[model samples]
Target: MKNIIIFGLFFLMVSCKSNPVTKLDNKTEVGLKGNWELTSVSYPNSSYIKINSFGIADSQCFETSSWRFISNNNQGEMALRKAGCPTFSSDITWYVNQEGNLVLKFVGADVKAKTVKEGYVLKVANLTENAFQLFDTVDVAGKTITLVYQFNRIK
Candidate 1:
């Protein structure tokens, strides 16, 4: 009877041991949980472009800065504050497309904002521990311009 009691106690103690929780393997949507930094940006079909300490400049015509990105419910938004001449703020609504691409919708901003008539689409070319790349396109008039914006994780 004592031996049986000892076995039962051992069994109970073992059963009471805490088990570690297992995380799900597939977490694509949850992948955008951390902070990211801008590394490189390219407007493939644009006439000319530049990336400086502030933000990005296009064709020596426009300059922008103070960028912020946020994502929730499979929808995302990227906002930027333009510096230099003709200052303004812009907010672009973004989402993950069915083809695992990122789509951007140009949402109107304040008084100094540049009203965009259309949108852009991008894809993740490379994702790493510290950096990633996004493939996109900017419509300069009626033309389809492709672009890739690379970013690094903010440590």
Candidate 2:
């Protein structure tokens, strides 16, 4: 009985698997620490289709939007300023997840981030010193489309 128990313990220990390690990239966040402007939003067949990004106003509303990303505390703010568009601004808490995705939570309404139930996740791509792109995939008419958000450094 002792021999059987010892073998069982060994087998159990050998079969146990540890959690996978997360590949979080801090370099991407470092590169994003600055002021930027949302230059454009585009997708396939965008001439005919309109998309309201971030569940906010029309895609055009985000044009010329100012964004400030503070790398120290992972805090930021975004404001939209366009004629005939809904006014919007928010304090944002953001981080790059293990998969190199940008995770964003809006906490501007004097609400704690922990209490915010919804957030936005976007794929970071084409990162450069002066520009980058955020890709968002959405389903329209039973088809998947990639939406691109272009950012340009304000220098």
Candidate 3:
């Protein structure tokens, strides 16, 4: 009887283990569902810039430090308002690759990349809890390029 009870408790403990990735319900959309702030950005050759998001309205307007991330499986959009640019608004489609990485597609938003900045789209690969990297084929001159943008969770 004692052995059986111990085994049962162990089984229960093991069954309750939760992985951050699994907590995300594909049906409900996961990590992107809350408020996030940009922590650090890495440029070519390991250059670094530290930044904090400031805005008014939860991700609706950038004030001095804040950005809101609201997304779904079919589509997701970021509303950025910075001290310099208060009237910021953009929408993008969110998709999941077979590898379970979340990607933001510009063309997926039904707009031409050339019409925007980089030729029409972007992709994010290797996303993990509290941090992710950004890949964009768009640059200031409209050339194909990729860079990793790292982010941390706030609140």
The candidate maximizing lDDT is 2
Each candidate's lDDT (Cα)?
0.51, 0.90, 0.47
Q: How do these models rank on lDDT, best leading? A: 2, 1, 3
lDDT of 2 by residue, 38-96 (tens): 99989999888888788888887898999999987889999999888989999999988
lDDT string for model 1 (56-145, tens) is: 334222222223445554333343433443444455555554466655554654422235556555676566666667765555567766
> What is the lDDT for 72 in model 2?
78
Tens-place lDDT per residue, model 3, 15-72, is 9998756233363236556556655444453334222222123221232333345655
Better of 1 and 3 by lDDT: 1
- TM-score of every model? 0.48, 0.83, 0.43
Candidate 1 vs candidate 2: which has greater lDDT? 2
